[model samples]
Target: MESNQLPLRDIHLPEAIDWWPPALGWWLLAILIPLSIALMVWLYKRITRQTAIKAARKLLLQIKQDQQCDNSQKLKDLSALIRRVAISATTRNKCAGLTGQQWLEFLDQSVKGAPFTLGIGQLLANAPYQKSPPNEQDINQLTRLCEDWLNAQTKRKK
Candidate 1:
């Protein structure tokens, strides 16, 4: 056969890659991106909450250690610290405006039994309005109770 008479093959290119149904890496990234964002948000919230609790605990310890404050002053400071911690760690509506038995009952809910309502913790409510200052023993018990309640509040989940 003569060279001019031979048949020739046409140049053919491979098919173009399909854009749909992305590769595995892209799919993993699509799933991981939202999950990582959600995890970060959750971690941020948890850290802030724990930080608030740690700061509150430090303040409570300082209040307990102060010797200059009299029984009445200590009672007032302890009560204020409890209120501040409760308001910060819990919903304001759940803790604020609670008084007398109601306040004690709210505190009791966090720990075992009704320590606040039935035990020395009750002193918190009456101490503020007493004719004389609370006794040293009662003050000590109340301090311990307040500290325990603070610890319980810290361990609680949202």
Candidate 2:
């Protein structure tokens, strides 16, 4: 039959797809990209913190094992160690300037009691100025306190 005579109709096309409401892959991609980036950043921070903590632990062990150094020298080393670790764990502006009571107070934030301010930990403040070395017992106690502070650092949140 002739097309015009047979009453044939012209072909019709479907409407074009809309731009909104993207596909599942695209939505997943949008969500996953940021999540992956956040995870990477968190992992990097965790690794760096762990590295610093490990180094501090090794140094603590060294200070404990050094037999030749007198108690006064050991005290000085311990003080410096704590200060270095504090600066690494926080901003330099936050810890580098702290001293005496203020420094002790900052340390007490982690330990159960206010040891730095009230207990043998106070000896750290006078450590540099003390003409004579602290007694062996006091040195031992202060060493334990420093160790406790180190342990707290590991458990602390970044």
Candidate 3:
């Protein structure tokens, strides 16, 4: 056959791979990345909240154990401890600036009974102003109440 008449054609290559439609693995990875990030954020929040509660509980224990701080000082410490824990666990708007009966009511909402508003727990508001320290029994009861609150034994309204 004449060279010009040879029935041959030049090699042809396939079209270049399309970049728009990614492979299945890439699509799965795109979907999974955001989910993994969300899960990590949730876990971090949970762990930090748990850690805050644990540290606050330890501080409360120290306050309870201290023999040097008189009842007045102990009450002061306990009040501050409760406020700190509350602020950490919730928004500042929920607990900060609360005083007198309002503060007690806020606390009451969490406990099984309205202890803060109706029981020895009310002393939290007054103990700071009193000239004399509260009795040992009252202090013990109030401390227990604080412990219950920190341990989340109290019902969560949320």
Candidate 4:
């Protein structure tokens, strides 16, 4: 038979792949990347918060037990410590500018009974400036209040 006379068929190929429904590996990568990033951020924040709390508590204990400083000096250090902890717990603008009743009120928000405003914590306001230091009992009470505030900050959501 002549070549032109013989029956023949054209070559055929399968359809091209579509990108809309990605492969299983791609779908898993898309889902896992964002989830891992979110988890890392959460873990970083939790670890930093715990570190700040632990350091603050240790410093507070040091201030409480120091033999070199008198109660007034200790009170001042405690006030400064609380300000630093508050700044870490929240933001500089929120914690730094506050003073007097406003500072006390801010500290009290994280704890029960508004202690910073109504209880032994009121000593944080002006006791440092008094000629006589806060009595030992008062100093001890204020330290406890500071510890309570730090613990409360840690328990709160980030």
lDDT of 2: 0.90
lDDT of 4 at 79: 90
Q: Estimate each model's TM-score.
A: 0.73, 0.79, 0.81, 0.81
Candidate 3 least-lDDT 10 residues:
149-158
State the C-alpha lDDT per candidate: 0.86, 0.90, 0.84, 0.87
Q: How many pairs of residues collide in model 1? A: 0
Query: Which regions in candidate 3 have their CA more than 4 angstroms from the true location?
Result: 1-3, 11-13, 153-158
Q: lDDT per residue, candidate 2, 41-145, as tens digits?
A: 888878877788789999999998899998988898999999999888876899899999999999999889899999999899976777677998998899999
Whichever of 1 and 2 has more lDDT, that candidate is 2
Each prediction's number of clashing residue pairs? 0, 0, 0, 0
Rank ordering of all candidates by TM-score, starting from the highest: 3, 4, 2, 1
lDDT of candidate 3 over 8-114, digit per residue (tens): 99999999999988999999999999999999987776666677788988998998899988888889889988888777677789889899999999887777889
Task: For candidate 1, report its TM-score.
Answer: 0.73
Residue lDDT tens for model 4, 1-158: 99888898788898999998999999999999999999998888778768888999999989988989988889989998889888776767887999899999988889988988989998989785677778889989889888888988878885
For candidate 1, the per-residue lDDT at 110 reads: 91
lDDT for 143 in candidate 3 is 93
- Model 4 spans > 4 angstroms off: 1-16, 128-131
